[model samples]
Target chain A: MDVGELVDRAREGQPRAVARLISLVEDAHPRLREVAAALTPHTGRARVIGLTGPPGVGKSTSTSMLLSALRAEGKRVGVLAIDPSSPFSGGALLGDRIRMTEHATDPGVFIRSMATRGHLGGLSWATPQAVRVLDAAGFDVVLIETVGVGQSEVDVVKLADTTVVLLAPGLGDGIQAAKAGVLEIADVFVVNKADRDGAETVVRDLKQMIAYARREIRGESWRQPIVRTVAARGEGAQDLVKALSEHHDWLVSHGELERRRAERAADEVAAIALRELQARLTDLHGGGHLPAVAKKVVERELDPYAAADELLAALRAGRG
Target chain B: MDVGELVDRAREGQPRAVARLISLVEDAHPRLREVAAALTPHTGRARVIGLTGPPGVGKSTSTSMLLSALRAEGKRVGVLAIDPSSPFSGGALLGDRIRMTEHATDPGVFIRSMATRGHLGGLSWATPQAVRVLDAAGFDVVLIETVGVGQSEVDVVKLADTTVVLLAPGLGDGIQAAKAGVLEIADVFVVNKADRDGAETVVRDLKQMIAYARREIRGESWRQPIVRTVAARGEGAQDLVKALSEHHDWLVSHGELERRRAERAADEVAAIALRELQARLTDLHGGGHLPAVAKKVVERELDPYAAADELLAALRAGRG
Candidate 1:
């Protein structure tokens, strides 16, 4: 139950310990800083892959296939599915959890789901911390699958080193993908469900889009590839894995991986600091200081901007 | 023009001046604090209404009908269509703009569209400030219409005094509404496109859900109303408006208005402070203070919590 033993067990691939660490992070426990400090030395080894697309695009199936492929290569894999779409939906409805039950008994595979149920500031606050916990737990690869319905996909981009944007054939997905703004965040484009009727058109459209994007991004080093896959049947899984490995190698050789990791760390630090500020502000509210300031603003005696400045000064004064 | 003149003109209900003020807020201009301070006294009069639902639920059409109905009652209205669903989709596709274009020259109506075309923190950060501008511009009713795809609706709840959740019949919208967590947030539920076959079923389902919710929520003051509307034909717009007015009265008489406004001011203050912290952090990054800390964390010499603490200390030192 001690932090030291939990960290030790997590590093030794104990699922219960890993789950506990993540729960501590999610709940923002008092000892969270201790857990992060303890886990820091063992982190930064996992390959974080983000899977995103429009709804019903087989993202979960693709993720499951990728997990199996990586495990076949003798790698320990962890899955973190961030479901921002479902309000009260959990564990059972997530396709990744349901479909990947075949690997439930495999000690090399671990899966966890994080859903947003009215959390302040939502997914961005807790995701990077959860990623760090998984990374420190000695997973060779961590797959992050998020429903690409809204801002969740954008948040996924900040955490994953390699982001694979999934797209299926029909439902006007080509235009939907462009409209949803996933074109810029994709490092590898997977046209899953390629056996469908309009799959070829989706593939063609993606290739053209990527071509135009490459021209627009002249100085960018890595060229994003479009791969076709029937992920449900496991066809083209090996090719997707190969493309991922090639992209990973390119990232390492070009030194972009280090830059990305540094940026991710900076974001994580900022998020943690902001959460701390919010908590401190909440304390001030409970103590009657913030309510008084807000009352003045609401009564038109003070402006919100000036009120915020006063609150910030109080926070600093308290810190001092 | 000077901020004083801009504030004066906006107060006088000049469209250009109001547009300029909102643009300044969207761009986070240097003089935003001044604008906020100036607009403080003129606000708190507008009845802020939020309209939200899933895609293809006729939210925009319903909004248009409501706008016309309010105008018939001699009310000046401002509409902010927060489209978090569409990235590049802006004012043109926003239903309030195109459907309400007949009111383009009506001095009593103003419409603005906000899309997340790569804006940092997106709509939630700027919405409260924008609402203040509209409120101060002498609009009797300010309607905020955000696509209820995900967390946007939750954010809308924080800013609006009356939230009207729209749902059409036969899209399984009843379940969708519950799944989107709108049941807890809806002050008035408007079933748009009620001429459809399953409209009564939708209304019945909503009533049952609300009844169950009321039982679960003991001591809640107000009961949510479900009104049917053929928005395209403007059949039930008056009833919807009446429902909104009743809810607003309830909010005022029950003293929930003050409580809600105070909480809103608190949120606005927190958002402004957080934005300032982010700007300061960006400056630190530019000045090498933050990147140095991030580097230490990335190199495993420092944990992220310690790095955040160091950065916060540097921020305090800068203030000193």
Candidate 2:
């Protein structure tokens, strides 16, 4: 249970060790910091990609196909599949990983599924940490896939170096708008199940959406590419891969990749801080001090802002 | 901005005081306890109802019709329409409130729209306080409507004495199974947009679903009432109202109303504690200690569990 040893073993390319270490992190083990500290300086080598969309949208299928294509090209690929947790069970619904059985024997591929145990964002607690694990494990490409909640896929934007939103045909316009906002974050948009009706419509809609996204980041240009694919058949897998390579080329050409990585690093710092604060706040509540404060707040003797200020001042005074 | 003064003014029917006080509570204003304490004893008097489902399920239209019907009966009703913050304006999507414009002049019916501000679980930080305000304002019933996020709908379940999940027809079998587990919490089931195709299939599925929900709570003898409604046209609205009434009667008959209220109060206690903890935990990461810890974690010299434990222990020991 000593987190330091686990981090050491995980870094030595031990799969079980890596998995166990991540479990500790997910449960908010106090030593998570030590593990992150060990892993932090070693990252920035892997290209982390994020894929997210509605439940039935064939994300898993596309991910499987992408894995095959990447590995065929002799790339060491690691997939961080963010799965949903069962509220009653407090464990992940591992159903999504059923399709990932093909590469179990392949040492060149590493797949880790992290449960979003009702975390507010679609991604889970240990995702960035796990990404670091994959990065240190020397994986050239890391793809993090999220089972997105309705109309909110913004979380992936913050997590991925290149965000891909996998959209199916037949979503119509308003639902498309909800997805439209998600599209703005997409470096590559794929209309999967292209054989289905309205594939062209989705592609056209994505183009219009890309136009809108472009206006926001005006003149600093690398257009969000729309790629069509039938993932099940691997029909357009090559084209999708080509689009990814071209997008990477475009990012390097425009100097956006380095800038984005810098932003992402800054975000990591903030997210870690936020995560730490959240844990302390939870502990304070579990202890006796907060409920009384809350009761007083509930009773109208205190207010939340004043309570927070008091708590913060107390924490600041207390932190050595 | 003293919430105590505002709560008192609001109690005295001062509109500005009411608006200002609710905003304070919504923002988790520090003096909330004082305001809430003043209003606490006024609650548990109204049968707070919650209406929730995905967007485009006619929740607003249903809310308007029910408010009008309740008003016709000469009863005071309060509607808390919850909308997500608009991506463009960073404010409540005011368009959601546009559906209820017909009752703008009706003093007997008060409709307020609040932003969720990215709170998952169908529970907003301001939700309970808003309900308390309406209750203290002497409304006979308070209906809090939310754009339900899947799985996270349990948040609304914690607040409502009766949770009504409005579902449209033809969401498909996969979604139906997804709804199966959550539907057990429902007191009255609604098939909104009953005129749409596959209404019968949805109702039939619910019947089968109730059988499972019933088995889960075998000792608790309650039959969930399923009502079909075309909310936009007011069709089946009366039956829906009747069903709600009968459900209330059943609650009283089974002595569940008091039990549910006690449960809800317990939940409020837990929620406050959890929020308090989250705030404190987040404080540690913000204190410039996390980056160091993350580096340690990444380096494999420290494991996450031990690191988390050490960090938390340090805080606790410092407290000592």
Candidate 3:
């Protein structure tokens, strides 16, 4: 399809076209960039909620419940499930989109599972693009469920309008709290599996931890709400949603919401450009341009560093 | 303390000088880029090995053991231990670094415990640059240790020549072998804590899974060796080291060694560029250029897609 037509269909909320368009964008150079340039205007229309936590923490379930609530409000929701995959392997490992039963039949709910796939953040290179797609397509909300937490998942903190971190009970008991990097990134924390015995305790502990964290970060006054949710039963989800609205309000009042979106926008553009340069560099390096240098360095004819410097200089000069 | 003098000292094998100089280069931008360009001739010297696994899987123990054996051969070693920190709070976290005891008073070993405070993948922006410093400082081997078995840790697979995926006795069982992403990236598979009862079972399971993976990925015959190691007691460590050497030879003989290095070099350069752009873009966007557009966006006075288009146009026009 022509780029214009493809964007039009994507804007029309065509899921297959949206997926194909992202594929084309991921594989292309100047055209994908032009597409990004075109889609930027549509980005802020859909409220993006990032759902993240450790694996098996009920993030997926909570996302489902949130999506259901948004749909009930007569809103068109787009679900972007980020999976971790090897670009070398071209796989989206462990996407649980199949588990989102309600959205399968809801035409208004467009669900697309993407992988960082060597894209570096457990998010698709075209994630911001795809979110724009959902936004332009008139989706009321875009819900992103990430594969796991920590560094890669933090990408969502910048990308999303709100980030919900899900934690199960018993997580705060051991050394797990030491590893819970999501505590700070979360706009709202969901103690999922509230039927479990330690739900209240987890909430209490998280509140205290957040309090300590706020004090340490030096004047971070917006308190991250700890919402207890039995996602399996869809309990406390409305409260979670309310917490999201409240957080969004807080961001607006504190002047951080725009700050973050701008940050993400800049990153999105730069990443698109670097990805272009990378693809070109790969072909040159793989075409035996560097092997002779490697052989010479291995033989001590010259050091590897000098050889690399020479190789890059040659590539820059187009003299190799 | 000047860069030139520091470089001189590092070249003369002064570890502290090397570390401090690399820190300066890393902490400063234009200086680091210029110095990195100048020092390009001395890097890619050390054989980099990235060790990753699920938390509490004895990654540090294996690293310490591996460092000892490498030291036994009179090989100088550098261990870069990474702890992932919480993003929101910016609190130091995941301190599994206490498990290592290899570098105390050993001139042959340099251990740096780094926090994944800013960026993820268990490496700081300074990591590759630091590795270059250590390489120039004449460390025979560089060992990078990451905290988790997730996408961020996968960065090691590309950064290191030989990537070891360490698995303990019981965490994330059955599903691990099914993790085609991490499993496929491993050059050496280590079931660390092999004295544990389920060690043999995990190995058997991994072997089967690897066999299936080998068949599935089709061509490009790279054999991944599964080495069972009781890391705490230093049992089977020699065998692990031997397998690493065997893999190295296999990679070289098959010409994969050169290919992989070329790929890593390209990735390293690209990642560096991407990181720089991310920082730059963040600065530019935060500096009051994009807020008017963002305000219009938040108030819904104009749609985001169109606003983004306008923003880009303004960016190109050097006005907003």
lDDT (10s digit) by residue, model 1, range A1-320: 59999999998999999999988876778898899899999998999988887656787888889988999999999998887653322322453467878888999988988765555546776788888888998999999887665665467655889999887877542544364265667889898889889888878877777777667754687888888999889999999999999999999999999999998888788777767777788788888878889899999999988988998888888887
**Which has the greatest TM-score?**
1
Note the B-chain TM-score for every model. 0.93, 0.87, 0.89
Q: Model 3: which residue pairs collide?
A: A41-B304, A41-B305, A41-B306, A42-B304, A42-B305, A184-B88, A306-B41
Q: How close is candidate 1 to the true structure, as a TM-score?
A: 0.94
Clashes of 2: 73
What are the Cα lDDT values of the candidates? 0.80, 0.66, 0.67
The list of candidate 1 runs beyond 4 A from truth reads A85-97, A176-180, B85-97, B116-122, B172-180
Candidate 1, CAPRI quality class derived from DockQ: medium
What is residue B253's positional error in candidate 2, in angstroms? 7.7
RMSD over all Cα atoms, model 2:
5.7
Residue lDDT tens for model 2, A42-150? 6678888888765567888899999999999999888887654322211223555788889878878888877654563234345776787788667889998865553
TM-score of each: 0.94, 0.75, 0.81
Q: Which residue pairs show collisions in model 1?
A: none
Q: Please give the distance, in angstroms, between residue A259's alpha carbon in candidate 3 and its true position after superposition.
A: 4.9
Question: Candidate 1 chain B TM?
Answer: 0.93
lDDT for residue B72 in candidate 1, whole number 0-100: 94
Tell how far residue B25 is off in model 1, in angstroms: 0.5
Task: Judging by DockQ against the true structure, name the best candidate.
Answer: 1
